[model samples]
Target chain A: MLTVVKNQILVCILSVKYNIMREMLNKVTFLMNVTFMILNNASILIQWFVLFRLREDIGGYTMREVMLLWGLTAASFGLSRVLFARVYSLPELIVSGKLDSYLVQPKNVLLSVMTSSTNISAIGDLLYGLILLAVCGLGVRGFLLSLLFVVTGMIILTAFALFLGSLAFWFVRVEMLSGEMVMGLISFATYPDGIFQGISRFLLYFIMPVGMIVYHPVHILVRFDAGMFFTVLGYACLLSVAATVVFYRGLRRYASSSLMEARM
Target chain B: MRRQEKNAGANVGVLGKREKYIGRRYGLPGRKYGVIYRSVLMENLQYAANIALGFFGYFVFIFIFIKLWDYIYQTPGELIAGYSKEQMIWYVMMTEMMWFGSNAGSVGRQVKTDIRGGNIAYLMNKPYHYTLYILTKYTGEWSVRLPMYALLAVMIGTMMVGPVPGFKIVAVPVMAACIILGLTINAVFKICISLLSFWIEDASPFQWLYDKLLLVVGTIFPVEIFPQALQPFFKLTPIYTVCYGPAKLIVDFRPDKCVEILAAQVLYLAAGCGLMFFVYRKGVKKLYVNGG
Candidate 1:
């Protein structure tokens, strides 16, 4: 069993490396794309920059805290996209019966699908997050804690997307719902959590769970709480398991569309 | 399945020959492009589920902005950056809806695909103005989608924050004109970016850059809120015309501001059209020179 797990990890790593290498073949273009995305994301920070310049605090968050919010969100989102890029395309895969390829392979299908590709621009997001964290005066300990939380956040986010994308098996054309959920997650994750109130707050924490993906992690990173940390860790683990179970269960309902196309 | 087969057959040159032959026979440019527009509009309308989902996504963003601004206001009548919270929220709603309503065609993505897939060669042989063909398709899609977006905006705006203050019955025609101008500016920007695919392997980066500029410069905040030093620079940007100008007028209608906005829109429209034509014509020449 341990050997099997190790083999899967090896395959995942190799696949990611291969994908990165393929993208980086044209070093100049890859660098340009990455630089453009970093600048694009940094420009978004200007909105908060102007907002903070106008007001002292927003919902109890200082500019520094807002930076942390954006930092964690960007880092986690980047990590998820880089490691589990298929999470974004799962709806298309399921609906189009592209899952047949993974099913035929003698490996963990979910992990195989998750690690199939890496987003070239997401590397920029990862670097930008670290830059923001550094600008916020994060020390080594803070950096380490952030890495841990970012990984946890990535897992939960990917799992959440999988759960949503799995709905495509049971229902036709839920791709929009999956897409909207992902967009909502990305949109809400960057904002200061305290601003959300009542039903919005509830949805943030539960239905959409942008809170679990970014807010909780940032909160724990800023001021470590044993209970909260454990809760987040547990939530990530449980959600990952639940997502996997739901996907496999739904696989039975995935009627092949016979629209298969060859991939390089 | 039959439609898919027909589409596949069309791609394999059967339908292309027929369409090309028809285009060559009929020198009626307007009718041919009109058919393209109707086809694209009908194609978009057929996907009701997709349209609803898109509206829902737009709603989610506006809903969040409303909540965020509601929290920011803190006081009932406080103004920041020369806008009361109500005006600010309304401004965001209008700008965000302008994005939804505009015919911002994914020309960049389409061009990138065409170049990467070597389909541009075939497209160049077609007997229509490629840029005009795309613009018409975009306009048709925008026309179909705009009503749905406007209805949702009004419904959501009325529910969340009530109607825009000082709105007049006459404001409708003026706003409609502004919306058309705004969409034209957006379409021109997209076409220019798409044209970049002739030179760059991935024009997507350029599109992302343009979108970010629009978001930060105009969509997220009104140009009035920009720093004094940057206000002129922001005004010089097409973003002011595309998103900020019309949205501001909707929230606070003034005859003078309306006139100024319309004049700027026309100027930007002309400039945008000129730039688009230059880029596209040059890009096509380059493509041909490179044996594309």
Candidate 2:
């Protein structure tokens, strides 16, 4: 029994190393990639700083207040890239038949493939995003409430990212399709979720869950609404399970092909 | 390393005397510059329809955001965050136009494909700075698209009920400086992304990453809307400086702050250009001439 346990650990280590290798080979951008990240991020920052400093209380938001709202939008976008950045990888995997190699691997292949290597630049985007959240968080009436919302919002975001990535199993050409959906979600996450009327709010809350990622959690923090905490927790748990089931189910449909077949 | 080629190197130094001319390999102008520029322009122009469609497609998004923002603010009939209905509406339109103006990303893929195919060495053999030549090519491309976007903006101007100009004063010199800085930053980004071709076997993932990030940081909504805690870091990031600075300057000019922003813009351009050189130098040094 002891030897068997040791063997299992060895297999796990090997699988981890293989995943790392696959990631390193793919994500390493010699020099150009670094420059691209620097330039683009700089432009984004500049736009944020300028032209957005005004305070008018039209909808119960000051200049900085709106900034805080906008900040959440940035956070959702940044987090999406950081965690589920691999969702963008699905189309190429399908077209190239690289998914075949994952099927033959020992570990939970879907997770391994999904997170071969986190986007290093996305770490910057994530940091930038959290900083935005913190800025908004500073205004919260209760510190503990803000932290709770952050945690719950993160849970919902993770589940959503997984659900999107799993869609690639059915749609081989899911790049633009997934991209558009995520962008639309970012659009939704930017605003205060409560502004939507009865049906619109319901659509966002249940149908999409994007509202829960940023606006709903934000609303909870500002007002210290107790109900949201439980509701968010329930949704996070349910969706996390759903994401796993969808990805594994998608895996069964992945048919291995060759470079020659792929080219054809 | 071949004996016959080594002995013949001295003779081929003379351009017309050699079977394949080597004159273009140095700073000297290749007679083919005009022809090369023309062909590149021609090839780019073939995709004009796609460019028009892309501009229109992105424009639709502005209206959607406008509707959404309007709905969010329906009950309260005052400015949310100092943005009047008209100013905020134009804000959406301007941001979209700003994006259309500053995109040099598509050309980045050309460099990556060339690198992957091992065809970049062919350009290295030409008599021009690769960076300058590529920038020139993209400048021509943008020149074409900028007008298309301007035309669309005019249509939006006439059709939309949003930010109409209170008056028209040409912020010419500032605008010029912004354009140059914007283009330089964009060109550098393309070069940076293209350089990844040296390390990554395929460039598709890198391209997608760049595009998505661009949508968020480079052009989308202004970063001021970000939470206060997040503002400083977003401001410091280089992308916000490049793509955001120019359009914001036009939409809302602060002459006192303009110099400082321009200075920052210049710094980013310099940094982006310098980074490209460093990358290209190292990348070429490590380059294995994979036979095409």
Candidate 3:
């Protein structure tokens, strides 16, 4: 019995080792990706430079602050693309019937969907982020705390992506919702979360949760505020739990219609 | 058997809840008889929401900019770098709408997808021009959007801080021209991006990159903020032509500058149209490469 089970495991491992093949891009894709990254970086640099004239300090943040904010933003945004861009693809997947195959899989459907498209541009965002973080100058103790903040911050971001993606099961056509969410996030993200005060700050922190995404961890690293660190880490874990519950709950009615028969 | 089917679905995760919560998001079914027209019209009627949201969003940034510029202009409190706070705000509102309205044509990339998939070949044997067919399809949709938007502009311009330019007879033509120019550039941009799907597999990144660049196309802030040395080069940029012409109206519709702006518009319209045709011809060649 043990030998038969061992043989089965070995067969599975051998097949896996062989089947994870990937194809190479034939020049155009390479050029497209490289050009897109270079141009995008150049554009952001220009905006940071131009907006510099608005103030040595913009909205109570310095030029270095702005650049670092942009850098961290690029990283966070890049990381989302690298890991969670498939969430943006939820509508198309449902419409095209691609989710059915994922539904029948033994593993979680969300995990499968996210893994399907490994985003390349996100690498650029990640690189830009690291450079920006290094420049932000958090010192040794500050840097360690900042790293902890960013890691937790990423968890909160993934939860947000999952929450938005789950809407696809109900809405079926949620392109605009996702786009509006992106715009709303961008509006809050471009400036320091400090510019917002009172109720608006509440919305940024707890309501929409972008402040947690940006300012929570940033506050520790920048010496703005440190107590928020424990709150953000705790919040991220809770949000992830809430998000998973929301997605699976949304997935239940997935009648999946007569369209994409490819899955079942 | 039915129970078995239900149980099969109930086994793993997300399936059960979607069944109960499926249709709760909207009440589109309320108008069942004209579901076809109503759905189409309802979809287009969403422009009201877009316009309202757009105005609110525009006002936020304008206030932020006003505060920023007020600090700069505090010494004189009149004008700085050829702009007053009011003029700058007006430019912000108009440019925001124009850029929004133009990029709205981005959905046309689905048209390109259809072409690449040879789904467009369905229309090839039809009697009408495919271009005209799409134009009318989109126009009928936008017609519902236009009235509400015009009203939003009127209300916001009249009630809220009020736009400097309004229903003035002479300004109407320029604004109309601006709207037309916005739609045309958007359509052409869509076609060019869509045409790329013929050669490359995905056109989405191009669409995203192009739209984001519109932020710098002198829409949110004047090109003059780019520093004195860069202004001439900024003026000559094709991107500047689409955004700046309408913006000029809000900035100051000078009789002398009208000729220049109009000339810029004519030049942009001609160039965009020319680029679309060039891309179309090349795209068609690529399509045939795949026996498509």
Listed models, DockQ each? 0.60, 0.07, 0.13
Docking quality of model 2: it rates as: incorrect
Tens digit of per-residue lDDT, candidate 1, span A106-200: 89988988899899999988888878877887788888888888888888989999999898889877888888878888888888878888998
TM-score each candidate.
Answer: 0.93, 0.58, 0.76
2 or 3, which is superior by lDDT? 3
Best by DockQ: 1
TM-score attained by model 1: 0.93
True contacts kept of each: 0.62, 0.07, 0.13
Ranking by lDDT: 1, 3, 2
Q: Pick the candidate with the highest TM-score.
A: 1
Candidate 2, residue B258: the lDDT equals 73
Which residue pairs in model 1 clash with each other?
Answer: none
Poorly placed runs, candidate 2 (over 4 Å)? A1-53, A56-84, A128-155, A158-173, A187-208, A238-255, A260-264, B1-92, B106-122, B140-292
Arranged by DockQ with the best first, the candidates are 1, 3, 2
Which lDDT tens digits does candidate 3 get at residues A99-197?
A: 777787655566666655546756666676666676677677755665565566566766777787777777754655655665566566666754566
